[model samples]
Target: MPSIAPDGKPESPGKVEVQPVAKDNEIRKRIADILITTSWFGEPRVAVQEGIVFLKGTTENDEFKQWAGDLAKNTEGVVAVVNQIEVAPATIWDFDPTFQELNDLARGFVRLLPMIVVALIVITISWILARLTVYLLRRGLLARSLSHLLREVMARTGGMLVMLAGLYLVLRIAGLTQLALTVVGGTGLIGLVLGIAFREITENFLASLFLSLQQPFREGDLVEVAGVTGYVQRLTSRTTVLMTLDGNQVQVPNSTVFKSTIRNFTSNPNRRDDFIVGIGYDDSIPFAQEVALKVLAEHPAVLSEPEPLVLVESLGPSTVNLRVYFWLDGGQHSWLKVKSSVIRLVKRAFQDSGISLPDEAREVTFPHGVPVRMIEDEGAVESATAKPTAEPETVATKAEASLQSEAEEIKEQARRSWTPGENLLTLSSSTDDS
Candidate 1:
């Protein structure tokens, strides 16, 4: 039967056609010709038998060997392919590829010369703009009252923003818009990571900023903050330094200072001090109060406006406890020295007036029995029973004589220790109550 074509035409019954199958030798020859044309393979051998092709060769890389196998497998009449090509070990270093790469890079650089020039110009202009911005900020009237640290921070931040904007523009001009975006995104990510990693440091930094702006306390001011009572020596970026009454230096973290309650004793010139004084139960409370008030009134350091107070606070086991409260000019007089003087004078007054201040009464018990001893001499007994005469007036100590504030000494010490610029506080701003 004759087969009909797709066009519906009848084929001739006598016409017969046969296509010859490609022999294994022909397939081998074709692959050999292809491998010879390329310089990738060396000493490549090709074999074919029974319509199956075999390939073996040495090439500089596996990619070239695979190329040879693919050529053989694609040849006509090839039933299967066995590729056993080995990658040759490189003996001598090839500098041609390296030279070619360098040459390519050089050409690329030449092509980007105009963009590089533009970027350099942009960087220069950005630098100038940043400097100008900082200069203007420093000289601006709005920033005149700001603390030195705050002003510097603001100026530097503005300059940095300008520089960043310039960088983004330069990247866009260089046809690296994606890189620019990455830089912008990466900056935020990096900042977040750094903030997390250095949490305490960041907290302290922010606290210092607030402290500077708030000006809660000033250098040389007596302050009790973060469980430390001392004269504020200086406020720095990381810590607030203090000189204690004991002449010891203490550095409290700014974060702690900001969070803790700050008691600025120097903020108010008039500061009150109190001490407990106990008198005998039999002693007249009114007489004792009058005597103590007289002593406080006589003291030069005590403020007369807020009349010194002597109130019956609590009754002790053997005595009447009185709380003596007095106000003094803290800025002019040392509260410690003034209080000491007042106490000494009060004690003298009480003693002179015969108002007895006694110790706590305690009953001693004898577990076994009470022992008794009799005096042999009558003179000794008489002398023991006799009351001693009143002693001469004692001279007041230096603390009582001089009630000057100790902050001056602390301030001098702090000044000697650090430069004025290092301190974030200004003496002029110290008086600001707000």
Candidate 2:
């Protein structure tokens, strides 16, 4: 019908003819062509009416049906797609040819049986060689000086590497080179991940190895490390064990023990002992010094090689502070016991020599009107210069002598106590002996 002209008369439509539009059938044919050419699409029936594509037919699977429908939906001039394609169910015919295929596969494997047997033989030989390599490295290559635990670990690691190499060769002989490469690549990736996760463990392990080589402190040695003082009980790959003086066990990480400052008391048998004595400022300094020096020199535990020293270190408000220094054989006796004895002996000498170890004194000033009361004890008061009832030697000598006897007994017990495990050098000697 021509459009109505604005003038009441039917306007003559311009001599124009509408070209015929392409029909849905042509679009359907193009969509079918596209579906047929797609590899994933099986036989899917296609129909089109009014530019809407309808898919219907049986395919091998749902994937083919989906792919055919998608191609139809994207076809030019397609309005919509209705997918009703069904997937075919397997029938006895599907298994008809599998028997022949299996037979062929068996024949092929039979033909390759000799190669398989040879590969297995190679693998078995490789395994045997790996074990032999481990034995040789453990008994010959590794130094006896190495810790036994470390030596074993290194030997096993070398064996594992050899075994892996053998496995790679077997895989290659079996025409499985791609599989071997895949395994190797995967192993490298897994190792990277584990190394990152166990970084601290690896650090402590390496630190322990270095410490073993350094031998800073041996088992049974008394050491101070990372603010802990104790006798070293054992050393392992990860930690150093210490038995404290109170008999409690402490486990320190090897990294901390290696990095921190360590004080090995038993490294040297001799150590210096120090004590401060306050004497009256009015007393003769020279006399006080001479008496303290003589007491230290006479003590049996004190070392005579390094002469005992007495120095006036500082002056307090009331008395003079004299610092007494003496060298004692730490291994022979307890340092604390000897120092206690020296203090007692010096105090008695001061009293006998009439040199006062004075207390700090201060004059308390009060307001002008304040009254002060003096309190006195009911007990008898002994004068500072009173003569001794017993001999000065008897009073000063008794306490130290008793302590020394007890300390000697303790020292004997400690000496008799033996610990387990061997240091690196000891292990080396034992290996040689065996």
Candidate 3:
């Protein structure tokens, strides 16, 4: 029978017989022959014993050393590889790998050039859309009733949303979908932290928005709110400014102003004022009431339609206390001046009518007989007790000028010191008749 080769093909009669197992020398020679074909730091020595190959060499880098070891291990009949290959120390002139890495990076960037250009175009379009959104929002009906600050906030918010959408698309085009999601989520997280950190400021801002919408008080309107009584000057996002009665500026937080009760004095042109006047108990209450009413009725600033009232409030130890109530045009006259003038005229009228205002009576009981003292100044005593003989001079009774001038001055000062847009109220409310 003809001998068959390992491939199960019948061998030719002239072919030499082949051995099934390779010799150690043959394995070593095979690896050495392959090594000579490539460039290396130095020629290495290769040895094999019982099919185990041993390699020893020096190479310029670990990659070359690893390549030599792998070459030996893949050789025919190799059982194990003991690679004692050493990599040469780097020299200052060795920059081949670094240059190769840079070249590869440059090639990759060139490959992504088209994507980068598209991203830039997307960003530009997004920017234009953002600006257009802002313009449209500002001119929309939604902004008509909004305050300047609120309008700006809304417009900017709308624009930012557009820009964010553009950013997301750009990030996706750049193949950074995960990064885009992180950016969006991080923005919301940062906003939440800021809101919590500035809780009071956020509250004030929201309150200001509501106040601007509601318009509880307008600029130049006399108002009392948050324990402050003043003329409203301006309303900012954080605070509500007022010029107090003493002509001092006060800034109350919008949150406090919104939560507190607001008393608008200028809302109604007519206001009522009252004061207590005490007269001697022997004087007839009806006559004193008539005299006081006459004084208020005769005053030019006093409003007669409301009809002034004089009621017996209480009886004191030595006098009868009367409560006098009267109305006046608050828009044209200062209430302080009107009340002061009315008091003065009423006192004069009482004196002219002989309505005695007596002091509180005090009684003293002497355990011993009252000590008598002889008075040598009889003429002085008589003069002190004598009533005035001249006729009572007429007293002037009129409301002084209103505080509108002072408020205007304050408003002027605010205009000089602050921006006109800071004022969230219209001038119509200040100039309109109540």
Candidate 4:
């Protein structure tokens, strides 16, 4: 008979074998050996059927049970493995319960109860003091006419400082100094992150503070900010609110307001109104200016002290442009109404003086001498062909009368909605927006 090796292969012709070729029992034995060697998995019974391994046992934990099956599956000659192992249910011995443990926990709570109560009391006192301090500061600042925004900043900063002090004391009293330090350190990091994320908000807030301190335009002031002209309704930490002439609310960022040009119309009681009058090139320039100044001076709303100015500004294609400048009491009369009055009065004065205001003229030429027929208005025809002795009525007088009637109508309409009162500064109730 030929000798066989452990792997079931025939040995060399002259070699002697000490053990028969590996069999099912040997493979099973090898798997069992591996499982027993693993200390994490308590003894799991192993059986091999048709070169397949089945594990059956309970371990201290699922990890150990899983390890037993995995170990069998990895062994040589094991086609497959079925892990039927389960974890042993926890027993009372695991907790080793005793009244002493409960008694120790209760005693610990009792020992710390007094310190906890003291800490809470300290925090409460601190909060009350902080609020009182803020209230007092607000009253004092408001009395001093300090900006509302400045007052809020000072009060909040003071309150936060006081609160921080209180918190530190509480932590110390409760023997949490390490925790207090951790919180303090973390606060800086949190603030850094928030500052980076909300840079625009921070910039606007700072700009608002600067604006409040500078006092560029107060509430209710008519101002032109960044080309937006309106009445300042409110000033918040981030935005400046305006009630536009169109009756819409506009919120402009404080940063933009601070950076852009601000025209404060309400700052001055007097404002100048300017308009251009174009007269026919053939008209008298000096006569036109004289008539304009006279018309401006005669108007009740125009200021006499400054004296109205009329200068030949430029010569246009069809006329000589006269720029008329006049001063008015802006506080008493609406700028628009005053300007409209000036234009009407100037137009009438020019007509009465026979200084013709020019209009655009177009002359079209025919290429082959085409005959042209001119049509005139019926009113113009009646005026041209009327009797020379018909009261000698001047068209200027009729035009002036029509203008006066229209002015009275406008005045009546304005009176319906207008109330007599001086424009006062709008005071904001609070400024703690940031």
Candidate 5:
């Protein structure tokens, strides 16, 4: 209807033709053609009326129905989309059913229910049995006080793996291949990660196993490996910990322990210790050797199986050297104590025998000159009265001038080459951090 003018004259309404688009039907038809012909599924039942598309079809899923509707809606002049695609049931509905067929169907359902119940029963029973077995085994192993780390990993992983196997059996019985595949995929991914990320960790684990089997050293054993000599305190999966000589707890990688040379001082109950004893050149070499051997033979700890050797090894400038070898039982034998005991005994023996043990060599030489033997006692004698005539100075004065120069030089050298954290920074702490 046309709007009324201000003069009160009614205008005619504009044309409201609403002429239908002729091409709209053709576009919808084109879309229907595309869907039925181009798709993987053979054809779809389609209909259109008054520029509205009604999708009516049998399809595998809602996806195909919506797809058919969308295709038609995208056409030039489609006004609305109506989807009426019904999903086909997987089981065929045979209308003409025989009595035997009906009975068989009932039988199938009944058998399926019983089998499912049986499966649940078997799973529960097997699971209980497995748990009981694992618990028994774990308790027995734990009672023996096995390596803590190994025991923990073994117990946990053993029970878990057994449980996983049982679960897989249950899944298989229920015909859940998809679920089983998911589990397999996850396990494969975990194995891959372990293989790639924990390369060193795996090596360390194997090395730890090797260490346990080898019996090269054990707890409280004094061992030397890779220049870090210490007593074994504990062994973990990745590393062997040691109480170092300086009292620092040192954790060395099992990989390193395996790769390096391992000297186990405590493996054997008896350890042979040897040190060269120096006597004055004038002292009888034969008498000195006997006295040294006698000193070792008198010690209770000395092993009598292998007689200790006390023979002249070398002739020093001021003394006659004799190699004194002795064997002692026990890992706790102190090196300092053994040497001190032998030294004190040797000194007493020599004194009783009227033999003089040579003191340290006192060579008289200037800084730049060749070492010279002093005929006079003035320069060589260690006495207050006798001193170097070049200048009269106290011992402290001479020591300050000479030793201070050495101390400063040592400090300078230390400062120039001393980088304490160089190797420490180079070592990895990522595993420990983790």
Candidate 6:
């Protein structure tokens, strides 16, 4: 006769009832078998009765306990899984009571006590060191003579950098980081996120740091940046304040200042001026040059350090171009004012000497095959009417002509609009759009 298998399906009847019993010994051996076969989960203490497996063991956590119970329940003849897992708490030696524990604790305290004392001593010493370091760096900057703002920035930043690094290592030696990591996700993650989000702020701060370190220009120094010419008024951690030539205040990012090429007009005390003096072709080049040199040298604001230069720089189509170069004391005189004064002086000097000055110039030569125009006479030109002539047509006739012209123009425009590219647009656009 046929019988049912352990899974309740049909099996040979001969295998019926010298039925196996599962107990502690048999279950343990089977569990070991399960472990050997799985190779990932360790052996778990198991007791099986009528194919129901009861699991008992100490494990790291629920996941490990579940894995062990699952392994036992999946073995042959197993019907169900019952887990009674005992979780082991993290082992810390602090609260153990024994002679060995006491001895170990004593030894540990002895070993660590001196380090604690040393740390305290070092901290006091480092505070002194930081103050001394601050003093020395500040004194050095003062001796070399940096701005008060710049010196203060360097002292604070440099001192803090040194002090903070020393402080972190001391906290580490005291096991601060290890203790913090055990609770929740850890302070490391908090620090990492903070670092990422504040990266730009860090860069700007460093830019300010560079500003302090380099001392590129002081307050009231003229600088041109991003097409704005201004005098630097204040420098801060995030931005630099500039007062523009138009008397407007502008704030520039410190990072942009660090990244860009800055032109400091006031860096050098003396500045060079250049301009072209135009005189008619009939005027003498040497005469104009001499007059320009006189004008530049006679200007009180011009510096005596660099000698003035005046020369016939170019021969133009209708004019002689004389270039004048001289050193000016600074923006003590405005650029436009100085330029205007020089041009006026030269113009007056030339008028007094009977020298002619022309406005615009271009070369015109008799090139064959080029068209030319000649006006009849100055009197004829004066008598000519500049406006277009009006035809005396009636209003109805004019309106009709205008209507016909508009119709023709509309048709012509429509024809011209159907270009090759326009055809592509016509094809791609929706029918409704058309």
Best by lDDT: 1
Residue 287 CA displacement from its true place in model 1, Å? 4.7
lDDT against the true structure, per candidate, is 0.81, 0.74, 0.79, 0.72, 0.64, 0.63
**lDDT of candidate 3 over 1-434, digit per residue (tens):** 22446864333323222256678877777677766666563768898999788888777777667767766666667789899988886688989889999999999999999999999999999999999999998889352655677777889899999999999999988989999999899889988999899999999998988997788887778899988998888888888988787867889999999999999988887899999999997898999999999998888888898999999999888889999999987777777887877888888889889999987554567999899866679898898779886533343333444323244565566556543336666533443433
lDDT (Cα, 0-100) at 116 in candidate 2: 85
* lDDT tens per residue, model 5, 207-260: 876665454665555788878877666566677776666655677888999999
**lDDT (10s digit) by residue, model 2, range 160-258:** 888888788878888899998987787789878987899989878888778877778766677899999877766777888777666567788889999
What does candidate 4's lDDT look like per residue over 1-434, in tens digits?
Answer: 33346864333333212245545677677766655665434566778888787887776666556556656665666678888877885566655346768888899999989888898899999999899888887877776445666778888888877888899889878788998888778778888898889999988888877877777877656789988987776677778877666655677888999999999877886889899989998888888888888887777778897988999999888889999999877666666767776787788788878999876665466888988666589898788778665222222234343222132233333334332222122333233221
The clash number for model 3 is: 0
Write the residue-wise lDDT of candidate 1 on 32-134 in tens digits.
Answer: 7767776557788899999788888788866566666666666767778899889996667878878989999999999999999999999999999999999
* For every candidate, C-alpha RMSD to the true structure in Å: 9.2, 13.1, 8.9, 13.6, 19.0, 22.9
Candidate 4 wrong stretches, greater than 4 Å = 1-118, 146-153, 172-182, 185-189, 198-215, 236-239, 280-284, 354-356, 359-434
Candidate 3 displacement at residue 77 in angstroms: 2.9
* TM-score of candidate 5 against the unseen true structure: 0.49
Query: Candidate 6 regions off by >4 Å?
Result: 1-196, 360-434
Native-referenced Cα lDDT, model 3: 0.79
Q: Quote the positional error of residue 63 for candidate 3 in Å.
A: 11
User: Which prediction has the highest TM-score against the true structure?
Assistant: 1
lDDT of 1: 0.81
TM-score of each: 0.72, 0.64, 0.71, 0.56, 0.49, 0.47
Error of 2 at 50 (Å): 28
Model 3, position 360: C-alpha lDDT score: 57
